[model samples]
Target: MLSSHCLNDDPWNKFPFTGFVAMISAVLTLMVDSITTSVFSRSGKEEPHADVASAYTPDQEMGRSHHGDHGLNLSDDKELGSTLQLLRYRVIAIVLELGIVVHSIVIGVSVGATNNTCTIKGLIAALCFHQMFEGMGLGGCILQAKYEWVKKAVMAFFFAVTTPFGVVLGMALSKTYKENSPDSLITVGLLNASSGGLLIYMSLVDLLAADFMGQKMQQSIKLQLKSYAAVLLGSGGMAVLAKWT
Candidate 1:
């Protein structure tokens, strides 16, 4: 008969312990990404303008004034900045999806390796709910990125297939694979830790913080409170799932 011990050492058992270390790694990554993106974005703006201004001749300056070209240049700059910002958001969304996909595959493999009927049932349920919520969160970021349909399709396809692929892999190796082995524990644990950190960082810095600090949320206290409640609800649901699967 399959037992809890056979299912793999409950990594959840290490919660708040190993989780703390993961949080630190995640926070560091978030800060680094933020700082680097900010520095590059600022440099992109200033360097181009400086180069253009330095090369301007008296004739060019006169032509610019005659054509009301200063305003056009400012408009073009705004458009360029907006495009760059959108590209940044798209990249962040892709990275966030990668982290989610890694964790999903791990979870799927664990579930697939199980032979216990009852254990499988509960795991299937929990995984369904888990993926549903995760997809919603990831979908929001992708939507905001405003990707072309083909790219969106590619991202969505990978996210949808990862868990199933993992399940198939696990099933094929079920006889030989030992989920509770020390090697398995260390490998899964480290992957889980890193992926957990990445999700936390993305959720906080890229998703929640961006929306909360935006003009729309900042201007409306009622809306902000509602949004906070929604976040809490989603987080609480995931926390509860942590106890089971």
Candidate 2:
């Protein structure tokens, strides 16, 4: 982003120092989040009620299929693993949404600040497909999270409103919010850069890795090949959209 109409525009346009810092910040932020999520998820083991615990004994433990200290039994272990996996997906959804929010805001603000009718029209067309595909991906994650209806609604509501809110904000400041201005360029560029980093990391690590490295995918060569084809097709479509954007 810093390569376009930015401080690095002169001579050979390239990503600037600011972009580097923003990318670094994104990495650090994700690292902290990863540690926090791992610690929290592990510590949040389901505990038996006090009464049940009081009556439980070594004999009771022997009766149950022990899966280490965090309770036993095959069904409960499966359920707990599923719950934890869903929780991880929920975190991914939130993080992915946050990145999308920042990116959507940048797109909306740029659209709002620019007076170029053709640019605005092209953006509007491209963004419709972009948001549609993005929503599909995020919706899949949210569905996997298996949140209650209220939480699902809240997440959907936030994602839906963010871009429009950015457009409104940009319009309110349009008089002074020059898209190419030093302040606007620096701010928007850094945000875009950081959000890009976050999105890339989450997509590769949390989303793709989860699916591609799973037992089902690993066990089926045909499925893996088909999945790769789908990923490439989607990626190619996004690349085309980026060109217009």
Local accuracy by lDDT, each model: 0.75, 0.75
Off by over 4 Å in 2: 5-22, 46-72
Please report the candidate that would top TM-score against the real structure: 2
lDDT tens per residue, model 1, 1-245: 01234434455353444566577769866776677567656665656343234234579667655775557978667645764576567668877888889999988887888788887888898999989988998888788777766778999998999999889877987898787776675667777777888888888888889899999999999999999999899888878877775
Instruction: Report RMSD (Å) for each prediction in the order shown.
Output: 7.1, 6.1
lDDT of 2 by residue, 22-57 (tens): 678568757855985686466545532211232335
> At residue 107, what lDDT does model 1 achieve?
83
Q: List the residue pairs that clash in candidate 1.
A: none
> TM-scores, in order shown?
0.77, 0.81
Looking at model 2, the pairs that clash are none
What is the TM-score (0 to 1) of candidate 2?
0.81
Off by over 4 Å in 1: 1-17, 31-70
